[model samples]
Target: MPLVTTTEMFKKAYDGGYAVGAFNVNNMEIVQGITEAAGELNAPVILQVSKGARAYANHTYLVKMVEAAVIENPNIPIALHLDHGDSFEVCKSCIDGGFTSVMIDASSKPFEENIALTKKVVEYAHDHGVVVEAELGTLAGVEDEVVVEAGQESYTHPEEVEEFVSRTGCDSLAIAIGTSHGAYKFTPAQCTRNEDGVLVPPPLRFDVLEECIKRLPGFPIVLHGSSSVPQEFVKLVNTYGGAMPDAIGIPEEQLREAAKLAVCKINIDSDIRLAITASIRKHFAEHPDHFDPRQYLKPARQAVKDMVAHKIVNVLGCDGKA
Candidate 1:
């Protein structure tokens, strides 16, 4: 199938009580890993490109890679998306550059400014047959160029969603309900130690999500910064000369619950990065004599496939949902 918008995918997810996985892609291995897993599972998937990704890999290259994935996996639905387009110009570029979906992240601006910016992008995107996803609240953490300090994070106010959606005319909305970007989603002070002294982050604010659902019935909701940050990968990184400490992420159980609700799309990036990094680090440690990129990246790509497969079956519950 050709690249499609998130419209039908979200509708099916909202009705079936499962969320489609939106995985960030920066290079060929990551794209292959994600789409291959989705294709094998018969699941719908979204390949997201952030502004940083566009800077890293040229937009033309990224789009061509996604097109290649589409040709290779013809059985499942796939959408090429811009993850966090910070401005109307950025959104417009993606819309004109063959992106099936784009996100106009104006949550950092004031309410009126956000609506105006999103509305402009929506008008342009809709005319071009691309769908728009707008964000309402700010999430704290670092993902590429997006950065928010710990105390600066704010949860989505359910009271504002109706007005925002009505005026902006965005196809879907991403709400910040305690989920954050990057591996260190929560600080050590914000979490409690478990029986084994592992840090357990605070829970997501479901009450706020439920209220938003009440106001926008049947609308597709999105959760960004939704990576689970598997500890085994963290352990492997640390074991192989990496020094990341106190890195934690949203629990898969909580994300599973969110998927069964109004949440129709879950963005996962850090987990894939962690899986690839850990695998590469381990490979290099074991075979220090090997210098070929393919030698190490082969296992790294497989690690991504394995991690994505787990999320499809366990966290997203969209396996066989194509």
Candidate 2:
């Protein structure tokens, strides 16, 4: 099947109380891993490209890869999206370059400026038969080119959501409700020790989410930085000569609960990166002579496939939901 807009996917997710996974793709293996898993599970998926991804992989290459995924996974629904688009120009480029969805992230701007910028992108995107996603609040942590330092992040003001969506006419909204952008989402100080002495991050601000749902009613909501960094991968990376200490992420149970609400789209990036990194590190540690990219990348791709499959069945609850 051809690429689809998120309109139908979000509608079904909203009514079904599940969210589609939006996995960021930068290259062939990542695209193959995510789409292959989504196809196997019959889950609708979004393959999103970030600004850094476009710079690294080139827009044409990324689009062609997603198109190949569409061919390979014809049974499931898929969408090409631009994640965290910083301006109207980027959004317009994606829309024109075959993306069925684009996000205009102007949450860092003042309220009025955000609305104005988002609205402009929304208008152009709609005209091109594409959907627009907009952000309301700043999320902390680093993801490619997007960054917000600790203490600078802000939660979405529930009061402003109604106005922002109404004026911008964005198809979906990404809200910051304690979920952050990277693997090290929280510092050691922000978490408490569990029985295993693992630093457990704080709970998501579902109260804020509930208020936004009450105001927006049936509108589709999105959660960015929603990856639940699997500790096993973190341990594997650290075990194989990596030095990522105390890297934490949103709890899967919390993300599951959010998916059961109005949140119809959940963004996951860091988890994919960690999975690949851990696999490659472990492979090299075990086999010191393998130098070919495929020798390592094959296992790294399987790691992504396994991680995405786990997310489809466990966290997303969208298995057989194509």
Best by lDDT: 1
Q: How close is candidate 2 to the true structure, as a TM-score?
A: 0.99
Question: Which tens-of-lDDT digit does each residue in 241-262 have in candidate 2?
Answer: 9999999999999999999999
Q: What's the TM for model 1? A: 0.99
Candidate 2 to native Cα RMSD, angstroms:
0.6
lDDT of 1 by residue, 1-322 (tens): 8999999999999999999999999999999999999999999999999999999999999999999999999999999999999999999999999999999999999999999999999999999999999999999999998999999989999999999999999999999999999999999999999999999999999999999999999999999999989999999999999998999999999999999999999999999999999999999999999999999999999999999999999999999999
TM-score of each: 0.99, 0.99
For all candidates in order, the CA lDDT equals: 0.97, 0.96
lDDT of 2 at 105: 94
| Candidate 1: residue 37 Cα off by (Å) | 0.5
Those runs of model 2 whose alpha carbons end farther than 4 Å from true positions after fitting are: none
- Clashes (N, CA, C under 3 Å) per candidate: 0, 0
